[model samples]
Target: MLNIADTLHGWCRAARPFALATVVGTRGSAPLPVGTSVAVDEDGTAVGSISGGCVEGAVYELCRQVLHDRGAPQRAWFGYSDDDAFAVGLTCGGELDVLVQRVDPGTQPHLAAALDETVQGGPAAVAQVVDGPDELLGRTLCVLGDTDSAHGTLDGGPADRVVAAQAGALLRAGRTARVEVGGDADTCPERLSVLVHVHASRPRMLIFGAVDFAAALSQAGSFLGYRVTVCDARPVFATEARFPYADEVVVDWPHRYLERTEVDARTAVCVLTHDAKFDIPLLRLALGLPVGYVGAMGSRRTHDERLRLLTEAGVTEERLARLRSPIGLDLGARTPEETAISITAEIVAHTNRGTGLPLSHLSGPIHRDRALVS
Candidate 1:
C-alpha cells in the first residue's frame, strides 16, 4: 500500500538517481502483487516494498546491482526450492518474478512525469517492457489516465503505439494487467512482456452521522484509503475539528447531500443516524444507487422498522436486499472504536468480494486485488 510513485516523484524532482525494482509476476502465495515496487538510491536507501518483509533484503541487493550496472533491465526470480527455502528462496512458499532497472530523470523523464501525475492525484499508468530483446529492455510507455495518448519511447514504432493503447484501455478500466506485445507474425517474432502499473484515486466513503461512532469510523475509513466525508444536519456536531480524519465535513441533510454529490460504483455509503427521518430518506436513495457498499446502523427492531418504512416509501424489494442493516460484521463489538473497525472491515470484505471469514478458515489468495492492497 505504499505510494511508491509519490516517493519516486520527489526523488525525480531532487534529481536523485535511483534503481526501481518491481514485482512483474508471482506464483503461489506471493506476499506482494505484480505492481508492487521499491526504489533504491545510490546509498542503498529504499522507499516502498515489493514484499511485506520477506524478500526485501534480496531485492535490495538486486536493486544495488541495477544501480551499479546502469545497463539494460534485469529479470530475476526467487522462490522456495526443495534445497533452500531458508536461503534466497521466499519463505512464504511463493515465487516472484522481479524486474530491476535504473531510473534517472535525465534518461527517463516520462517516468518521472507519470509518477508526478500519480502523486498529484491524477490517474496514470506506467507500462514497462519487462521481457524483450536487450535493446528493448527497460523501454517504457506511460499512458495518461485522462487521455488515450501516451509518452515515453518503446522503439518509437507501431508496437509502442499498440502498447500505449492497451495500457490506456487498462487505465480506463481501473485495472492493472500484464500483456504480451509484438508476438504476432505481422508485428515481430519476439514476444514482449509488459506490466501496466495503474494509479487511481482512492474510493470515497460518505458517513451520514457525526456521532462518536462516526468520528471513529471516519478515522478507520481514512486508514483504509477512503476519501471520507462526514455529513450531518446538525452543524454543532458536524465540524471539521471533530472529525479531523475525514476529507470533508458538511452540515446538511444526509439525503440531500448524497443526492447532489457525485457517487460511483466505488463509493461506500454508511448511515449511522438511527432517527427515522434521516435513516428512511437516505436509505431510500442510497439502496438504489450503484455504490459498492451500503450499511445502516441500528438494532434488530430498528432494522425491521426501517425496512417497513422503506417499503412503505416504495423502495424496491431488489434494492432493499442490498441494504446491510445493523451496519457491521457480527463481531459483538461494544465500543465505538471497535464498531468502527467492524464497519470498515465489512466494507473491505464487500469491496474485495471476501467472505469476511478468518484466514485460518479460508483456503484462497490472501491478497484479493493488487490495486486494493494499495
Candidate 2:
C-alpha cells in the first residue's frame, strides 16, 4: 500500500491543498481500524483507505466538495445500520466516525513532520485531537518515539500533559481513546471531548534461520504486514536469492545478532535453527529480553530434546515456558508454505488474544477488521 503520510508530505511541499480523513472511532464491524487515514489531493486521487470499498467513494466525493467549498474542518460519523447507510456507510455493517481536516503549510506542520517521520520509519501511530470544540482544533501528536509532545495545543498545562501521557500509553498499545478533561487547577475542558487517532503501522518479525521453512515463513509474514528479517550464520543459505521476500538477510550468529538490537513488546522472534549448537545460545539470549513473541520450530521429538538441553543448560521453568516450541498453532500443516501460514496465524492470534475459530461460528461483533496488507 502507498504510504498516505508521504503522499500528504508531497502535497504539503508542493503547496497543494488536500483533505485528510482519519477513522477516529468505531462501534461495530468497521472495515478499518482507528487511525486509518485517507488523503485526497485536489485532483481527487487518494492514498490510503478508511473503510473497505464501502465508504471510500463517498469520502472522496465529500473531500472534493470540502476542497471546492473551502469548508471548515468537521467530524462525520457513518453508522452501517442506518436505513440509507449503504449510500455513504461502511459496508461491513459497522459505524465509524471520521475527522476530516483541510491541511496547509501553516495548519499543523508538526503533524505533517511526525507523519513523514513515521512513514520513513515504516509504520507508526499518530494521535490528534480533531474535536474538543473548547480546547484544541487540529492539534496533533506523534506517539511512536515513546513520548507524546503536541504539534500544537488543545490547552497547555498539567492537564494537557496528563491527557498526552494517557494517549501515548494507548497509542503504544495500538489503540485509540476518547478522553474528557476534568477540572484541574490550571485549566480543564469542562466536559470537553477530544478524539485521539492512534495509528500502529505494523509489527517487526525477525526469523533466525534461513532454511526453506524460513523463506516460506518470511513470505507468509509479509502477507500479515510484518517487517520480516532472515538471519543465518551460513551465508549461502541466507542469500537473498533464497528468500526474496525478506526485508533483510543477515549473515550472523543468532545470539550475537540479537544482542546488538532492541526488541520490544511489538517484536516477534522465531528460532528455526533447530540444532542445539545454535538454538540453545539463541534461546538463552532471547529469554532475557521483553520481546512480544518468541518461538522455536522443530518436530515433537526435537522440541523435547531442545527442552531437555535447555534444562541441562540451566534455563529456568519460567523462562522455558515463554518459548513456543514446535512453533505454531495446531493446524497440522504438512508443507512449508502451509506451516508458515500456521505460524503466522499463531502470531496474529497471540497479538490480539483472538479465539481461533471460524467467523461463521461466532455470534458477537468481529473484533476489528485489520487492514489486509500484503
Candidate 3:
C-alpha cells in the first residue's frame, strides 16, 4: 500500500479537494488492518489502498458522495457474503467499517501539518471523532513530536481534552486504539468514539552486506516500511549509489557498527555477509541483542562450520539457537531478487510470530494483532 499521509500531503499542497476514507474497524479476515486509508480527489484520482483492491470501487463511490454533499463524517460498512460479494466485493470473506470524510487544508489545518510530519518520516498521531455529535464530527486532534504536544481545534472542551490525552498515550505506545470520551452523567452523557491513528517512524532494517543480494533486499526492506541501512567494511561497495533505497550507507565493520547503533525490538538484522570473518562475529553479537530477527545467509555446510566456530568462541548454546542459519524460508529461490524476497518474507513472518504458512492452509484470521512490542 502507498503511504497515505505522503499522498495526502501532496494533494493538499496542490490545493485539491478530496475525501479521505479510512478503515477504522474490521472483523473476520479483513485484508487490511484498521488505520489503513485511501484518499480520493474531486478529479477521481485516488492513492493508497485500504483493502488491497477488494473494495476500492465502492469506497470511491462513497468518496464521491461525501464530496458532493459536503457531508458530515460518515461511517459505512461492507461485508463479505456470497450475495453481496459479487456486488460490493471483499473476496477475503471479511467485513470493514470505513469512515469517509471530506478534507481540506482550510478546515483540517492540524491534519495538514500531521501529514507533513508523516511525509517527513517524523512520529505523530491523528485522533478523529468517528462517531459523535454533529459539531464534533470530523473534528481532529493531532499530536506531533516525541514530547506529545497537542495541536488542533479539538482542545479546550472537557471531552476534547480527554480525547487528546488518550491520543497522546496511544502515540507513546506506538499503537492504534479507539477511545471513548464523555458518557458520564456528571460530565457529559453522550459518548463519543475517537479513532487514534499512530504514525511512528519506520522500523530499521540493518543489512550487514553490500553484495548483489543486498541491493535487492534493500529495496524490499524499504518497501516493507524499514529504514534500511547497508553496511560493509569496503567503502567501494558501500556507496549510496549502489543501494539508493537504503536510508544510510556505512563503511564500517559489521559487528562494530551494530554494537554502537541503536536497535529496538522492531529492528531487523540480516547478516548476508557469508564470510566467517564477518558472519561469525556479527552473529555472535546479534544473537545476544534484543532485536526482532537475526539471520545469516549461507549453505548448510557453511552454517555448520560457522556454528562450530561460534560455539568454540564461548557463545552460549541458547544464543546460538537464535540464529536463522539458512537465512530465508525454503522457497527454492535461485535469483538474487527471489532470494531477497524469501529473506524479507521470513523476516516479516518472524516479526509477526507467523508460521510462514500459506494463507490457504491457515484456519485462523488472516490478519494478526497489529500491536508491536511496547
Best by lDDT: 1
Error of 2 at 188 (Å): 4.3
Q: Poorest 10 consecutive residues of model 2 by lDDT? A: 122-131
Rank ordering of all candidates by TM-score, starting from the highest = 1, 2, 3
- Which portions of model 1 miss their true places by more than 4 Å? 14-17, 41-46, 131-137, 153-193, 369-374
Off by over 4 Å in 3: 1-3, 10-18, 38-72, 81-86, 89-91, 102-104, 131-137, 153-194, 222-225, 235-247, 275-277, 299-321, 369-374
1-374, model 3: which lDDT tens digit per residue? 12477778888788788998988788888888887888888888888888888788889999989988887878889888577675687888888999998987776677888888888878888988777787777678898887556788553466656666777777665667777777785435667877888887778899999999999999999999899999999998999999999999999999999999988777889988899999888888888898888989999999899999999988999998888879999898999899999999999888768999888987878777655221
- Cα RMSD (Å) between model 3 and the true structure? 4.5
Give TM per candidate.
0.84, 0.82, 0.76
Q: Candidate 1, after superposition: displacement of residue 50 in Å?
A: 2.0
For residues 282-322, what per-residue lDDT tens digits would candidate 1 score against the true structure?
99999988788899999999999999999999999999999
On lDDT, who's better, 1 or 3?
1
lDDT of each: 0.85, 0.75, 0.83
Best by TM-score: 1
